[model samples]
Target: MENGIIYNSNLHFEHQRWKGELAFWKDELKFFNNRLSELVTRWTNKDVLAQLEHYQNEFVLHNEVIEEMLEDIEEHETRIAGQSKTGADALDTQMVKKHLEFRNRLETQRHIYSELKKEFFRFLEKYM
Candidate 1:
């Protein structure tokens, strides 16, 4: 953001970067799900199976959150594009605020997801 104004080019780049990160997370989640499936199949202990089920539910919920965030990002990008006065115009204060809010939400999601990933890996090490 330059002088509280976000240029169109900058916004586009930021949006693309965030979208790419989200896509990678989605793919990683799928891989994690596959691993969980394998563990669930091999494990027979009731306690271990229950923990696997818990992780499955968490991953599913995180997937939904990722999808929702992607949709919201698309809508925000569309809105920004629609409001652009010129190809290289800058966003207004309100748009800047909105973009910052999105950035914060994205960071929060990333942090939470990272923690979840670490927890899952620890479980795998202990049980798998």
Candidate 2:
């Protein structure tokens, strides 16, 4: 999202950068799940564990869907490249549609991740 990860004493800068990426929906879904795992490890509340588990399960499903969409996109692209002018045009339209659908689903997953992160942090604040 930020193009690269940095580590230094510029805490506020780092946070601002991360927040900027989140605001732009540029952060990857996989990274969000990784951060969730890190948060879960620091959590001591058993009640929140179930909710985290649910999020984890949802992430697995999202990952599967993302993978399938990527495969479909690649397949369509290949077909378009190998087809005639007329056929290629049709595949091109279909590819764009699939790309948009995939992006919409990805955005939904990102929103879910954001909500989960907020909830987990709130739980930590309340219980930890």
Candidate 3:
């Protein structure tokens, strides 16, 4: 039926969107993890203890966002399974809201990460 075809198309589009989001989150997390590792290797001074602690805390916060992104992907997968059209629509709306929130958090985390990296480099230049 035409209705079935339309529903299938919508479902396919939704899946594609979800896949894009998954890829984006995975890439962001990988970048965050790599940066954290690099920072750890570069931090060699015991005197910069305050900055080190701040970096560690920010790293943990970024990690929590990554975890939340993974959880959101898992929930989306579960919701898509055998879902009705109405349910899927509702889930899509919820997903959009969640995506917006995640994006805002990601932007904030990125800004913090950049600031931390700049400070770390400045500390190195000043002390080392």
Candidate 4:
């Protein structure tokens, strides 16, 4: 049997939620970047400096990814709004597929961010 359809309203809510999560992550990355700056100024150990630089680069990359994701989410939300104006009760199969893809990407990013966060804390505890 074919999978059932999803409501546009539901997708809209989900997109909003995803945007909120991304915003929170962006703020967290900013905070981490700030902390890394402080750590960099205080430490001169070669190994620690290397690790700190790595984190600094990672945070910048993560922030860029978050910005891209936010843009994608905004576009998706716009498409959903357009679809809703047509009085459609269910999203198209293609839209549903895109939704799943977006969700998967978000999950993967979250996992990577979580691991990086843990590793960063461990580094802090070990060096600081």
TM-scores vs. true structure, each candidate: 0.92, 0.49, 0.46, 0.92
Error of 1 at 7 (Å): 0.8
Candidate 1's C-alpha lDDT?
A: 0.88
Model 4, TM vs. native = 0.92
Off by over 4 Å in 1: 85-88
Rank order (by lDDT, best first)? 4, 1, 3, 2
Stretches > 4 Å off in candidate 3: 1-46, 81-91
lDDT tens digits by residue: candidate 3, 22-126: 566557556655655665677676756556566567656756665666576556556555465455433345554654575576567557656865775685566
Considering summed lDDT, which 10 consecutive residues are worst modelled in model 1? Answer: 79-88
Q: Which of the two candidates, 3 or 4, achieves a greater lDDT against the reference?
A: 4
Q: Assess candidate 3 and give its TM-score to the true structure.
A: 0.46
Model 2 lDDT, residue 128, Cα:
47
The candidate 2 region of ten consecutive residues with least summed lDDT is 1-10
lDDT of 3 at 13: 65
64 Cα displacement, candidate 4 (Å): 1.2
Looking at candidate 2, what is the lDDT of residue 41? 82
Colliding residue pairs in candidate 4: none
